[model samples]
Target: MQAVLNAISDPTRRAALALLQGGEECCVCELMTRLNASQSRMSRHMKMLQDAGLVIGRRDAKWVRYRRNRDLAPEFAAVIDAVLAAERPLEEDMA
Candidate 1:
C-alpha cells in the first residue's frame, strides 16, 4: 500500500519502527528522547505509522504508547520486516 511505503520512506519513521520491533509498547516521550526529536515531530511520525496500519497506539493518561501492529497482513509484515532488517546495518554503520 502506498501509505505503508510512504510511512516507511522517512528515516525517522523507519527508526521508530525499529524501536517498536522489539515487541514492547513504547511511549511517545521515550521515542522523543531516543530519537532526539521534539514531541510534535514524534507525534506526527507516529501518526503516519498508525495511519499506515503499521502500528497501533493506546492512550496512557496524557501520553500515547505504541507497538507494531501484530495483526498486519502478511504482505505488509513482510515489507516491514525487510525494511527493519535492512535498516540495522545502516544504524550500525552510523554508530
Candidate 2:
C-alpha cells in the first residue's frame, strides 16, 4: 500500500514507529530522545505518519503524544509489524 510504503520509507519514521510499537503512547520529547532526531525532523516524520493514518497524536498541555492507529488498515499495520519484528536490533535496543 502507498500509505504503508510512505510511512516506512524513511529510517527515521521506521525507528519512530518501531519505538511506538513498544510503548504506551509517547510524547515528542520521549521520541526525540529515543530517535536522537531534531524537533523539526521528528515533526515532519510524525506528520507523515498522521497523514498515512498509521498514527494518531494527541496534545496534552505542552506534550504531544503519539500512538499507533489501532483502526488503521490491517494490511499496512501487518507490514509494519512484520518489519519491526524482523529488526531484532531495534527491540534489543529498546530494552
Candidate 3:
C-alpha cells in the first residue's frame, strides 16, 4: 500500500494512470508524447508504476506497451479510483 501510494503521488504517474484507466494499451512512446516527457523519464515513471503493481507492461517489439492492472487488490483499486476521481479536475484543466 505504501508503494502504491508512493507511485501515485507523482502527478506524472497519475496522468499516466488516467490514460491507462480507459483500458487501452499504450506504448511508452505514446505516453512520452502525451505527457511531453523524455524517453528516459517516462521509462523511469513506468518502472515505478510497474513495481508498485499499479500497471503492467509488455514488450511490443522495440517498445513497451502498458495498461492498468485489472488484477489489482480491491483495496488498491479503490485507492486508485479515489485518487483519480480527486485528480479529475486537475486533469481536465491540463487538457
Best by TM-score: 1
Please list the residue runs of candidate 3 whose C-alpha ends up more than 4 Å from where it truly belongs after superposition.
93-95
Q: How do the residues 1-95 of candidate 2 rate in per-residue lDDT, one tens digit apiece?
A: 78779788888898888877865698878888889998888998998998889889999998889998889777777888888788867668889
Candidate 2 Cα deviation (angstroms), residue 84: 1.2
Q: Which structure is stronger by TM-score: 1 or 2?
A: 1
Best first by TM-score, ranked: 1, 3, 2
Q: lDDT of all the models against the reference?
A: 0.94, 0.85, 0.95
Residue 93 displacement in candidate 3 (angstroms)? 5.1
Tell me the TM-score of each prediction against the true structure: 0.95, 0.85, 0.94
Lowest lDDT 10-residue stretch of candidate 1: 83-92
Clashing pairs in 1: none
| Residue pairs with backbone atoms closer than 3 Å in model 2 (clashes) | none
Model 3 scores a TM of 0.94
Candidate 2 positional error at 28, Å: 1.2
The segments of candidate 2 whose C-alpha lies over 4 angstroms from its true place after superposition are: 89-95
Top model number, lDDT: 3
lDDT of 3 by residue, 50-83 (tens): 9999999999899889999999999999999999
Cα error of candidate 2 at position 9, Å: 1.0
lDDT per residue for candidate 1 within 14-93, as digits (tens), equals: 99999889898999899999999999999999999999999999999998999999999999999999988988898899
Q: Is candidate 1 or candidate 2 better by lDDT?
A: 1
